[model samples]
Target: MPVSEKTADRLAQHITGGFAHPVFDAQAIFRAVMDAMARPGTVQPVKLLAQPPQPLSPVAAAIALTLCDHDTPLWLDPALRQTQAVASWLGFHTGAPLAGTPADAHFALVGDPAALIALENFAQGTQEYPDRSTTLILQVVSLSSGENLLLEGPGIERTALTAPSPLPRHFVEQWKQNRARFPRGVDLILAAPEGIACLPRTTRIRLSEG
Candidate 1:
């Protein structure tokens, strides 16, 4: 269903209206997300009102609310395709376009990382405007282990938590290739039901090669 003006107005009211805490508190969440993205391999927290639909956890919705807008083109994975609630909420709140392919998307919501198509399938930016590439919102298993991987570069004060997931071995390699394109590679936000983390293209990830 299309987002009616009435729904948009209500959502705007809810967001702009007063909160128990300072209004900037919500704005602060946006800053936190930006900071996290600027430096990948790091975790950040944000408050959420209600749980978002499948594939898109509450944290993802919070991120979407903070960053997406009519200007952002969103690509939803199969898990989120039929989720009218999210589609309606996004349409009502941000008026984001539901894109048909990764290459055409500004941001993508992926539920099944294993099922996601090749990374090359998405925009890799260009020589003049590498920042034009896409950003991915990936729903992962967890962010607790504190062991089992290696993350380095850009954001690291000096290497942070051991990556919590057994990311596909090929992803790191593909990212290396993507980075050669410089500024053209995709940025990423890994989210779980409990928390969220960043993996901007600038971050260099090395899986434990054993």
Candidate 2:
């Protein structure tokens, strides 16, 4: 049977690979994300789920696929935005729109942690709707290799310590400010080759004393 023209066109399109088992994979990644969010400082493992092109780590891509959707506007850092592959893969898989500015993003992905823009530049939800703030997922070298961080707040029993490598520029100072905002601040998800760790806005962060 001769293939229809529409079918032929679809077949010829070079679709970047996403999750092989979309439903199961997304569910597993989602669970990992929730675990990290709830624990605040513990790194939760996520099996490799996607193979997005350069600059977009597999873990970051999987998180985007699992958490983002058409309604969520996404912002990409300069490194990731330097090429079209990362954005194209995300848009194709998640249907998320590219936000023109960081302040407008519902979610933002940073590929270069050390050079990341200030957290305050992104969406900080108002007091009336705290959940409207931006959630940033940063691609870093490792979840366990960076400077030690002392954590204390809700979800923590007393305190927790985490070291996510190549810490963002002025992260310690920035986090204190973010915490001070209380119900209005950006939450962070640090993604590494091994897994992910979260720092919800309610969590207090400071450089650990030697």
Candidate 3:
């Protein structure tokens, strides 16, 4: 079907601008994401990218612009997928292929944390190629210090803390299963208006008691 000029214009309006300087902007966002992943539970601020559709945080938009491309298969939850503006924007900017199922996605974007799909539903890379697992990008209400989860693992000197407001139901329990998968679980990037935090497959998490 041919797209009308009006529809094109509306789509364009939602398509956010990529980094001001593609190379530099991408490099900066990449570094931020990498650092967050390396130092699990640490929040890293992201430079603003194009303003994406609703439910797509500035940080999530930045990550998509920085990391996704035609080579990656992206899966958007119903909240994001149902919006043509979001689909058009992502298609125009990242050129990432949309996956039919979570297991086939290299990256999965979840706008509603409370309604997130099961962790096991996504790709868990095989032992011989553990790095191929899906990397979940979740948009949360906030990433700040409050009720937190104690994190411990390769990156922590002792233990680190993270509190992504309003996490998914049984998130800690699900994380335990994800951790038990060892070299075969999905990694995560939690995004908020302020910034982002990561929970790689190697990180260990537990609820912090009051």
Candidate 4:
């Protein structure tokens, strides 16, 4: 059984919808993810959608399917951690192992952004191997309805503003510290119904004065 067919078979077993066409769906999601990551702070549409269990948004689910694999350890937040169905669905589809702690995850999915674990708690990688850091996918209320954030960095020629709601408390403060880590910090992917946006470590963020 090929991975795509095998995935379809498993999708039939679960109530949640995995990609109906795994290959094409994953490719579209991958390209969307790459675009978002490359742009940093820009909202990008995820062309593919997946109906993951409660607390796991479609965009986030599509991301997990496209990016996670057997080699990437996944961490779920308390809200998602307690949801057994979420674990089973992601485990079966992505073949990613559950990480024992936030620090251990290569990719951490945060279903509840309001009470997210401290950014400092996750693996920050080392100056020698920055890619070891965790990449967080967070579900938020809206992509443009929260606190206005001004971002400037490699991706934006001048500056960009975003306002994803229900972010963890002290996010700007925490982000300043995270930014100070330079090449060793974790990157963030914010998901909402409208789509997804990113905050690569190379990007600088602050509460927009505007």
Kindly indicate the candidate among 3 and 4 with the higher TM-score. Answer: 3
lDDT per residue, candidate 2, 121-184, as tens digits?
9999999999999999999898777889999988899999998988778889999999899899
| lDDT of each residue in 1-210, candidate 4, tens digit only | 467986776565455589999999999888777788889778887654798877788888999998999999999999898977789889989999999999999999998889997999999999999999999999887988898999998989899999998898899999999989988999998888888888899888899988
- The lDDT per prediction is 0.69, 0.88, 0.86, 0.88
- Candidate 4 residue spans exceeding 4 A from truth: 1-16
* Distance from true location, Cα of 189 in model 2, Å: 0.6
Q: Residues 34-91, candidate 3, lDDT per residue (tens digit)? A: 9999999888887676577766777788888888999999999998888877877787
1-210 in candidate 1: lDDT tens per residue? Answer: 899998886555434422234346558667777777766666776666434544456666666766677998998877777766667666655678988788988888776675777778887888899877888887777766534456778768876555655343367777787667676788778776566678777767666654
Candidate number with the higher TM-score (1 or 3): 3
Q: Would you list the rank order by TM-score, best first?
A: 3, 2, 4, 1
Q: Model 2 residue 108 lDDT?
A: 95
TM-score of decoy 2: 0.92
Residue 116 alpha-carbon offset, candidate 3, angstroms: 0.5
Off by over 4 Å in 1: 1-26, 145-147, 166-169
* Candidate 4 structure lDDT: 0.88
Total backbone collisions for each predicted model:
0, 0, 1, 0
Worst 10-residue lDDT window for candidate 2 reads 8-17
